[model samples]
Target: MRLSMDLELQDIPGQLLLALQPLKDNKANIISVVHHRERKTPRGTIPVRFVVEMDRSKLDAVKSQLVSLGVTVVRAGEVRFIEDVAVVLVGHILDSDLGDTINRIDSTGYAEVMDLALTMPGVNEPSSAYLRIRATGKAEIHKALSILRQVGEEKKLLVIEPIEDEAA
Candidate 1:
């Protein structure tokens, strides 16, 4: 399963590696790691987020190892973003308040824009944006797409959804 873990570690060198040692020892597949370097928690520890794919049975052992090594496990659970889709919008995306559009989908609490890329040709020209949205499930993904469709109509943008794979 895909699991996300929040950890607090000392600012000393090799702490990050030490925190990851348990995951390595348990044979978890590392997906992503985000280390907050400048932001230290009140406990004088740096916050690090990790996403990995590992068997359920190994999770507890990994946690025990981490705690024994002095790593603080703030949170650990299954990841929610399981369904993902790519979408495109072509129009005055920036002029229409891109942040609000993204917020509309994100405020649903089931979906979020994971990646975004925007391009504008000229000052008065329309712009295009590529959005990678991840949702908790297919139903949520559809809901997010519907919200985007409504936003597109209101903003006069062209929203394009990915074509379904018939074989899948």
Candidate 2:
């Protein structure tokens, strides 16, 4: 069986290795891992992605082991996040508390901010960023976007909603 897990690990030495130890202890074979050290979850935690192959019956045990190790499992299910949404934020992202904004969306537990790109003109000029968010369902995506919009409005940032590609 193929399983995908989203985990939050502490930003410290050997934390990633500690998080992976559960899978090894449970005999789950890892297929791929996408670890982002630059980007963090809403709680200033590192998000780690893992694709593992193991016996179907051992899935629960692997999850249990991960939990025991104090790793926060953000998502663990058969239904993958097949939908993507992109939004652009134009303003002083760095000064507006970007970490808090990201945390609000991630705290929903239904959506994840996958990628972010920032463009800074200068110290005095306003900055802009493109955020790619992924959610399991349309409702969850809307919820995340709404939260982001609220945060932007509160911070006086310009939020440009994504235009869906009709051709896709």
Candidate 3:
């Protein structure tokens, strides 16, 4: 099963590798890691988010190993973003409160903006972006798309959803 972990690591050399040792020892294959250098916990440790895959039986052992290594495990749970949808936004995307647009869908608790590619022709020209959104299920995906469309309408941007023929 896929899992995710939020960890607080010591700000020192090899700390990342040290923190990852538990995942390796427990046979969890690393998927992605987002090391937030700019964010720190109250103790001044760095925050690291990891996505991984492993057998359900190994999860507890991995968590225990992580704690033994002095790594603060903020959260550990099964991965939830199982459905993916593609969308496009056209017009002055940057001017239309892009962050708000993304946040509205994410704040719904059913979806999130996973990846994005943006284009800008000039300082005053309209911009566009391709977004990859992930949701908990197909119904949640449609709701997220609906939210995106509403945001687009309010911001005077053009919203383009994925073709219905495309597989989720």
Tell me the tens digit of each residue's lDDT in model 1 across 16-95. Answer: 99998899999998866767766789889998877788997898999999999999998787866889999999999998
Per-candidate TM equals 0.54, 0.53, 0.53
Query: Residue 25 in candidate 1 has what lDDT?
Result: 97
Tell me the lDDT of model 1 at 110. Answer: 59
Best by TM-score: 1
RMSD of each: 12.9, 13.2, 12.6
As a TM-score, model 2 comes out at 0.53
- Candidate 1 Cα misplacement greater than 4 A, ranges: 81-88, 91-168
lDDT of 3 at 102: 91
Writing each residue's lDDT as its tens digit, candidate 2 over 17-65 gives 9888878977877755667666787788898877677776777777788
Candidate 3 collision pairs: none
Question: lDDT of candidate 2 vs native?
Answer: 0.80
Q: What is the TM-score (0 to 1) of candidate 3?
A: 0.53
Write the residue-wise lDDT of candidate 3 on 1-168 in tens digits. Answer: 777777899999999999988888888888667787877778999988777878888878888898999999988887678789999999999887889999998666657899999999998998999999997556568878999999988998999998876575
